[model samples]
Target: MANVAILELSRNCAKTVEEIVKLERKIFPKHESLASFFHDELKKKNSGLLYLHVDGELAGYVMYSWPSSLYASITKLAVKEQYRGQGHGETLLKAAVEKCRTRKVSRIMLHVDPLRTPAVNLYKKYGFLVDTLIQGYYSSDRDAYRMYRDFDSS
Candidate 1:
């Protein structure tokens, strides 16, 4: 998998709102509208993501939002369910961090469902701090933990 290809997607991929919304639904079953995806919710966030492919097939993806400030945020990170535990998620995350570092981003933050132990553990391994958790952070259906990491400025 050392030769796996990773591509940074352009803003426009011609994907239908329905298909994109379907993917979001997998993560947030109470899924919001696609309108919010490009507007109000992550408006200030300029997405910098990489699609991970192994053996020419989609393995995983990491989507992070670069704000061009001292901090950045990861909007989403997921590996196809069948592909979990193979380190693809970690690889995707490292790619995101590398991209942020290259762009001079010093801090990165992300929200994950508190009950998602595997994800929480993976993030902890990557040095993210448990920043804060709002009781109803995710939605009425789930609670989320906000994790953060700030890198050395030098």
Candidate 2:
């Protein structure tokens, strides 16, 4: 594992959005974040954007939203193609879970393409169970699995 730091991003960090977009393009070319999208998310009180820096370079990011205190939803998770398999993804994910815990969120959930076996496996490793199959969740051609990890905060 490389020396990685998980940093929360904000609108004040002007370059952060560009770096995140570049990493998104490399990992998920089909879905890149627009400048405005990042801008809006940063302005939202309920949203979080965290990036994993390996050796001080942008390596990956995980974005999530907690609409209420009861639940948190992971909106995005991506690791640079070259940096995959180095535990960056897992680190980012666990960090998100902790964020939710701190917020007193009872459940954390995310949607994943069924084809992304590695991601599904990682979620399972963190005790996420398949909650349901969402038809055409991503697109008409793509289906998704709604995974959930419930916490016993009591």
Best-performing candidate as measured by lDDT: 2
Model 1, 1-154: lDDT tens digits are 3567777765565452233345555655555323346434333446665777677666667778777677788877877776789888888888888887777878999988889898999899999989888687666777889999889978
lDDT of 2 by residue, 1-154 (tens): 5677999986688788888877666565364344347678778999888999988899989999998988999989999888899898999999988987888899999999889999999999999999999998877888999999999969
Cα lDDT for residue 29, candidate 2 = 36
* Each prediction's whole-model lDDT (CA): 0.72, 0.86
> Which ranges in model 2 have alpha carbons more than 4 Å from their true place?
29-36
Separate clash counts for every candidate: 0, 0
Which numbered prediction scores highest in TM-score against the true structure?
A: 2
RMSD of every prediction: 3.2, 1.8
Residue pairs in collision within model 1: none
On a 0 to 1 TM-score scale, where does candidate 2 land against the true structure? 0.92
